[model samples]
Target: MTVQLRHLFALATCALLLGGCASNPPATARYDFGPLPAPSTSSQIGTLIVADITGPTALDTEHMQYRLLYADARQARPYAYNQWAATPFQLLGQRLRANFAQAGVKVLSTTDAITSPTVLRMEVNEFTQSFDTAKSSQGILNVRASLFRNHRLLDQRTFQRSVAAPTPDAAGGAQALAEASDALAADLLAWLASVPQP
Candidate 1:
């Protein structure tokens, strides 16, 4: 081919390559529990050890999961372009610790120094955003909370929180889930107050 023809072929090949790259999917969106209140320095109660949260294998992933109750309620689906910064189990634990600390309750991790302290352990039963209709949805969090003292179970109960989504999409689901987590934390704190302490 002539030089002019060869140059045109090279330009077309470069254009095609660039177009292919442009067609790639959008960047993934990562989310977290959002901003937190300043941690309190006062300790109304003794140091409390928060054990690592436990949950099903699915909850152990960073995927932002949801359920189409109006369609297939039994199947959980993950967002294609959105994800949590960490697993739901880890995010719940962090949120709980933050909330407790902000409430003037001393919070410690399981890895921290051990004492005959009050302990809080949680197991997530279900965590997902459920769409009841094409335009309505809510975030649902169900967990089993157990309080321990001196390695003895002081009290145990299950808590469930559901918060409506402002929108019917992933962004709304994340916000709803965050609010539901806060609600769950508040409930746990109230329950601890009413339970008989050792």
Candidate 2:
């Protein structure tokens, strides 16, 4: 075959291979908090509404993020073949609602159309799986919480948790993140109990 014809053939073959690969991407894995633990038998803390969680625009999506602290702690990267079943906030909210209800707290939604003197709000500051070394990683979650009465601030605090990953891959990161999120919820619940409700 002529040199030019051979080159053209090679380019066509390369394009076909690339197109096939693009069309058949690897299966993506989705993660979420698996299940609720044993319910709390405590009585209701009284009527309280949980406002929708707010955070930086980055946390508004279904991306499962991680950071390499040993490399560039400032940069967060997404898993190519792993993701959350929903936005991080959505999942966290579900867990919080369930936990509060299980604890016998008369949990109310922001849209419940009911009057309540107490409301809980959260602003997620950071949520990512951070790797300190090639084989060492932890899921870090940081959030600022505010308790309000009559739309005025009643109390506020920042909560943070870091759970070690069982392994070094995305699966491990996901598990660690789930644990960290649960820890945050526990902390928030305890704090609520301490606040002077109106």
Best TM-score among the predictions, by candidate number: 1
Model 1 TM-score is: 0.87
| Most accurate candidate by lDDT | 1
Tens digit per residue, CA lDDT, model 2, 96-196:
88878888788899899877878999999988899999999999989999998888998899999999999998899888888887788778888888876
Determine which window of 10 residues in candidate 2 has minimal summed lDDT: 36-45
Look at candidate 1 and tell me the lDDT of residue 132.
Answer: 97
TM-score of each: 0.87, 0.86
What's the distance in Å from true for residue 192, model 1?
0.5
TM-score, candidate 2, is 0.86
Clashes of each: 0, 0
Clashes of 2: 0
Per-model CA lDDT versus the true structure: 0.89, 0.87
Please give, for residues 51-156, the per-residue lDDT of candidate 1 as tens digits. 9999899889999999999889999999999999999999999998998888877789988888647889999999999999989999999999999898889889
